[model samples]
Target: MKPLVVIPARGGSKGVPRKNIKELGGKPLIYYTIEAAREVFDDDVICVSTDDKEIKEVVEQTGLEVPFLRPEKFATDTAGTRGVLLHALKFYKEEMDYKADTIILLQPTSPFRTAQHINEALEKYHFGLDRVVSVKETDANPYFVLFEENEEGFLKKSKEGSFKRRQDCPKVWELNGAIYIINVNSLKNEEVSEFRRVKKYVMDEVSSIDIDSELDWKIACSIYYNIIISRNIDSK
Candidate 1:
C-alpha cells in the first residue's frame, strides 16, 4: 500500500507551552515519533506538517525535510486535524505529483509509541476499512462508572446495564491518539468522526500515554528514565 506518514506538530499548545518541541529525556518531544516513523517508512513519504519554523528545524535536524509550512488558517487553535491532513495531501498531490492511498497520522504527543506499534497497526488496516486507530481499554466504563445527569439532576449510568462489578462490564476502548491509519478515499469523503467502518489496534496503558499536561510530562519523563532507558540497556 502506498502510504504517506503525517506528523502534525503545532506550535501553540495551551496544555503545556511549546510542547511539540519541548525537551523530554534530552531530546525534543517530536523526535521520538520522527525516529519511529523513519524506521517504518522512507523520508520521502513522511511529512512533518508544522506552522512553526522552529518545529521544522527540529525535524530537519534528523535529515527529513519539512515539506511546507502550514498556512496560518490551519495553524490556529480552532483548526481541526481534518483540514491539516487535507492540506498536506493537496501539497503532495499538486506540487510534488505524489498521491498516497493511505494516510498514517502520528501525533508527537505519544513518545512511547514505537515503530513496532505502527507496523502492527498497519497490518490490521486494509482499503476496505475506514481507519485502524490505536486504542487502550478505557478504565471509565459507562456501564459501571460513567454517569450523566437526567432532567431531575440525578446521576444515571451512561449506558444501561445490570452489571454489578466493573470487571463484568463490557470493555470500552478509548482512542489513544497515537496512531491513525486512515483510508485516503474515505477521509476525502467525510470527517474521521463520521467513519463507521473503523477498527481498533489495542495498546497497553504505558504505550498509550499521551502527554497533554504538566503531570503527563512528569509521568512521561519518569517512564523514559525508569523503564524505556532500562529496557534499552538490558537489550544491549
Candidate 2:
C-alpha cells in the first residue's frame, strides 16, 4: 500500500509548554516518534507537519524533511486533527505530485510506541478497512467504574450492567493516540470519529502512555528510565 506518514507537532502547548520540542530522556520528545517512523518508512513518505519554527529545526536535525509548516488555521487549539491530515495530504498531492492511499498518523506524545507496534498495526490494515487505530484496554470500565450524573444529581453507571466485579465487566478499548493507519478515501469523506469500519490494534499500558500534562510527563520519564532504558541496557 502507498502510505504517507504524518507526524503532527504543534507549537502551543498549555499542559507542558513547547512540549513537542521539549527534551525527554535527553532527546526532544518528537525525536522518538520520528526515529521510529524512519525505521518503518522512507524519508520521502514521512512528513513532519508542524507550525513552529523551532520544532521544524529540531526535527530537521535528524535529516528528515519538515516539508511545510502547517497553516495557522490548522495549528490552533481548536483545530481538528482531520484538517491537519487532509492539509498534509493536499501538500503531497499538489506540490510533490505524490498521492498516498493510506495515511499513518503517529503522534509525538507516545515515545514508547516502537517501530514494531507501527508495523503490527500496518499488518492489520487493508484497503477495505476505514482505519486501524492502536488502543489499550481501558481501566475505567463503563460497566464497573465509570459513572454519570442523572437528572436527580445521583451517580449512575455509564453503562447498564449487572457485573459484580470489575474483571467480569466487558473489556473497553481506549484510543492510545499512538498509531492510526487511516484509509485516505475514507478520511476524505468523513471525520475519523465518524468512521464505521474502524479496527483496533491492541497495545499494552506502557506503550499507550500519551503525555499531556505535568503528571503524565513525570510518569513517562519514570517509565523511560526504569523500564525502556533498562531494557535497552539489558539487550546489550
CA lDDT of every candidate: 0.96, 0.95
In order of appearance, the predictions have TM-scores of 0.99, 0.99
* Candidate 2 C-alpha lDDT tens digits along 163-223: 9999998899999999999999999998788899999999999999999999999999999
Residues 93-175 of candidate 1 have per-residue lDDT tens digits of 99889999999999999999999999999999999999999999999999999999999999999999999899999899999
lDDT of 1 at 105: 99
User: Which window of ten consecutive residues has the lowest lDDT sum in model 2?
Assistant: 190-199
**Positional deviation of 166 in candidate 2, in angstroms?**
0.5
- Model 1, position 160, has a per-residue lDDT of 98
